[model samples]
Target chain A: MRQRISAVVIGASWGGLDAYSRVLGKLPANLPVPVLVVQHQHPSGGDKLPWILDTRTAMHVVAPMEKEPIEAGCVYVAPPGYHMLVDVDHTVCYSLAAPVNYSRPSIDELFFSAGHVYGPGLLGVILTGANDDGAAGITYIKQRGGITMAQSPVTAEARTMPEAAIATGCIDQIHDLDDIGTVISELVFGLGA
Target chain B: MKMPESVTDEQVSIEDIEIRLLLEAIYQLYGYDFRCYSKASLRRRVLHRLGMSGMPSIMAMTERVLRDQQFFVTLLNDLTVNVTEMFRDPEFYRAFREEVIPVLKTFPFIKIWHAGCATGEEIYSMAIMLEEEGLYDRAMLYATDIDKNVLAAAKKGIYSYAAVKQYSENYRRAGGKTSLADYYTAKYDGVIMDQRLKRNIVFADHDLATDQVFGEMNVIVCRNVLIYFDRDLQQRVFRLFRDSLDMGGYLCLGTKESLRFSACEEHFEPVVADMRIFRKRQLMKRETR
Candidate 1:
């Protein structure tokens, strides 16, 4: 069976905004899969991430809503104070849970769920975070034959998270945030096409 | 002290017992203590792992995680964070060269602890700096982090070509002797860093949160990593760094992060105040009086 990448799960922390802005902003509107983001931010306060991100990029962004089905060409964020998970039917689900890796809207939770539903059909990207939160989930995606990428530690504002993923021996590539869009485009165009 | 047979017993529900049991099971089975990670991050990481394992619930995931050692390793990767870049803060590199590298020339051998060295970028940056300063041959660099996965990547030294542009700029700002482009080869437009930079570099798994100091270091560069930690954790890490450094050693932190409010502030004197670099001080004879 031919594997198709239908979804992308990305995690970021610290200097993630610049990378996210570059990658997410450049995403073509006709993309075949939905891009889900988990950017670590304050629990009680967020400065209109969707708007800020929207201004920088072309991708239409919105925080995922409860029970909403995943959609292509749209970006879904794990809103503050929630762990966004994809349901069995590919619907987005949210919960008011305590922070993970000391963060709400954790990238691990989002990637893990996507890996479960999509298995090898998912692509997990771990970018600029301060702690070791996404390594395990990225490995899980790879275990199910999903593609995984980590930000080049040199380019990350905070290298701990990407370093953690790389340490797992599961990452396929390490790219700077600026070039991540090209990788995503390649994946979207389908590998080995 | 045995209870009577007629005593009523209350059974704990599996769901209620599951979260706690899973956390405990991970600790007992794998020995990567995650019991202290913030609740939200832990819950999020475990739940995601459960989905990836195809286990119906945390309990099922726990059973598999405990029984399968490999699975536990996978769980650890998910639970930990792995986001990083090399020369992340370009100014810091510039500061290191201007203020720190000059002082390092006096030492016969240099031991640098790049605490939280994710994917080895900073270590490589340091290697480049040391090489540029004619010190690479005499330096032993220790790149340590709790993330085993990233440590492995740091060892590989491969990167995407897209990053080279920013890295090139950062390199120039940090005072590069040669082209940053010279560091890696172009393969399918992807970048593979020079293997020479990794020489004498040891990438290992060490947690600053709970683990004791592994070796004495001449300088410790634990940058922006401290911002994520609470005050107590920061204090603990500062103490660890203090203990790990030799007298007259150097301590470097992230641009926004500082040791002024830390419990161990008195132990270090500012070397480059604005850059957040500090030097371990030898107490004056008058202080003893």
Candidate 2:
């Protein structure tokens, strides 16, 4: 079934840069949806993730300036030291609110907010992570009728997050790292070319 | 199979009810407003407090929060997380000192508000910057926080000596004109801020979530505080700051916070966009027709 995915939310931590490079690498230059990502890193090193990802991906990658628009075909990384949420108004909102699950830019905050706002139009991907941060978020996505995907635990560098997400019984698919991006493209643009 | 119509889904949970009632109880009993905080963060904190308090659930926790004065203070501390640092983002200070201070030089006097200034690190930083720039004598800083405990510490102008090492690094990076050691003296485990820094500062209790804007000012430095608020409250605070700041006054937000979706965005122009510093537009007064 080809349900339109208006936005994609990706959550990763611990081994995220490699996971992001792999996934974002496969995305086409003109994919027609906004992609928001949360990759937990040190409180001071936000510039590195987007800088690194921009080289590996076709899409425009940025750690957006405050109040920057959320545009399609652009990849937005959650800046360090803040929790980022996709507003119901379709703009990205950042918060310095206390950490959730000991993470400033917690995967749950991004996924849950995007899930609530985008609802069935959202697709959430939980990537390699050390902690169980994205579990409740994927559940929220499911409750909102959004599609959820997890990198197959067997293929993940840190399988805890994927396994936890799968435990929620909300993931629509558990995919190999190589196939996850392809699955997203097929879901968003469909298989027929 | 269809779901039961009588059963309400995730939109309304038992915890949600408990949280609502808890917030209401706190407001009615203690007059501290948590009603407009970002919901998820509030819930997380309340649940954390619940776990720490060894209460069975939020309902039980709410009862204790309302009745126990000491416990309420703990809950208040949990709600307002003042994880702040001196020269937290050194770039912000550098931008303000380089760009904004030049414009302020045109004025005879300057009034600055350190809104939600957790432990006054920002207040001290600003004081030092202004003093070095030859502007502190003409500047008055109003430092405020919702949590009185933090405000008390801020008033003392002392921080752990261990932490001063990082602060020194931050001071230099923030374009400090003189050595940071000139401003503070070490006393055993903690360092006492120079008394001159407090000469022009007024520390007060101002709750952005509930209180009214006090005095008009030339510049307002409210950094990471807005991140704790939901959109509605954020807008309310923006409007308050807009009203509090004189036309052409400066407003510096958290580096990560933006005015893109703010209701008051039009009233200000970006001074340093990437640093989240904005200037209120100098609107022309209209002649009556």
lDDT of 2 by residue, B8-30 (tens): 23653666789889999989998
Q: What is the TM-score of chain B alone in each candidate?
A: 0.79, 0.92
Evaluated at residue A89, the lDDT of candidate 2 is 57
* Residue lDDT tens for model 2, A1-193: 6577889999999788899999999999898988999998878653578888999999999787544678889999988888888754576666665788899889998887777677778899999999999898888787777788999998999999999998877788999998988888888887223
The CA lDDT at B55 in model 1 is: 77
Report the CA-based lDDT of candidate 2 relative to the real structure. Answer: 0.85
Report the poorest 10 consecutive residues by lDDT, candidate 2 chain B.
B1-10
Window of ten residues with lowest summed lDDT in model 2 chain A: A87-96
Off by over 4 Å in 2: A1-7, A28-34, A46-48, A51-74, A86-93, A97-102, A111-123, A129-148, A153-172, A187-193, B1-8, B11-17, B51-56, B285-289
lDDT of each: 0.76, 0.85
Report residue B243 deviation for candidate 2 (angstroms).
2.7
